[model samples]
Target: MSETNSQQNINTAVTLLERYAEGKRNFSEANLGNADLQGVDLKGSDFSYADLNEANLNGANLRGCDLSFANLSQANLQDADLRGALLFSADLRQADLKGAKLEKADCDRSTHFPQDFDPAQVGLQIKDG
Candidate 1:
């Protein structure tokens, strides 16, 4: 995507998130496909069931964010901090999670990880709970 387009997308996402925080708008299942949200501070944001397919989330600080059931297929999440984030049932197929931090992230059967990914490399420990 072009620089202008990327900026526009980021602006739109920020606006939407601000609206959601203030209760001015509701994006319960909004489609944010292919948006560039790199380096954004979206901590504690609610993105449950949102369509985030192919979104660029590199270096984003998403600690404690709610992403339950969100579609994150092919999303760029490299080096993103997702500690304590709620990612239950989130679709992560083909997503680039290289060097991402997922400590304490909620994962289940529906959560998808790359085929050759080492959970320990990303600080993820699969426990039998």
Candidate 2:
């Protein structure tokens, strides 16, 4: 990820998560690239078109969330609950999706994936353009 936005993303991630505790949701287009958000319960939040490259979102509860077109390349998304989430055109190349619950998640051919990863094998629904 680019370091230009990394510093701001650090503070944003912390403050954002803190606010989430107080019931704040809509975080669309946030500059959270390279943020460390591991194990956060951000279910049902909006993260569309956000710059989340290399973010540590491991074990996060992201069920029913909107992540369409978000940049998640190289992110640590291990064990994350992404069931029924929107992932259309999301860049997920090299992301660690091991054990993530992708059942019913919507993605399109524009969504990037790891070389060996198969969205169909993981129960992700292919969205038509």
Candidate 3:
């Protein structure tokens, strides 16, 4: 990433963290790639089109979050609450979803998965358009 882009990312992460601390949870299209946000309470946040690849989101409260088109590849989402999350077209390749609660989360054919990953086994529903 360019230095400018890197700086922008840092600023965005800090802003999001501050807003989260102030009880603001709507963060649509936020660029949070590679950020360490483990154990954060972000329920109902809108993360659509956000780049969360390689981020540590373990144990975060992401229920009802809009994660459609987000890049979550290689992210640690273990034990995260993802119920009702919109994951259509999201890149989840190599993401650690072990023990994650994905019940009723929306995914579709456009959603990429890691090798041997099974959404159905984890109660993730496939939404057909």
Give all candidates' CA lDDT scores: 0.75, 0.87, 0.85
Model 3 is weakest, by summed lDDT over 10 consecutive residues, at 3-12
TM-score on alpha carbons, each prediction: 0.77, 0.88, 0.86
Which of the numbered candidates is closest to the native, going by highest lDDT? 2
Could you give the C-alpha RMSD of every candidate to the true structure, in order shown?
A: 7.0, 4.9, 4.1
The order by descending TM-score is 2, 3, 1
Badly placed stretches (over 4 Å) of model 3 are 1-12
Candidate 2 local distance difference test against the native:
0.87
* 1-129 per-residue lDDT for model 3 (tens digits): 554343234325567778778776656556787888899888887787788989999999999999999899999999999999999999999899988999999999999988999999999999888
lDDT of 2 at 30: 83
The top-ranked prediction according to TM-score is 2
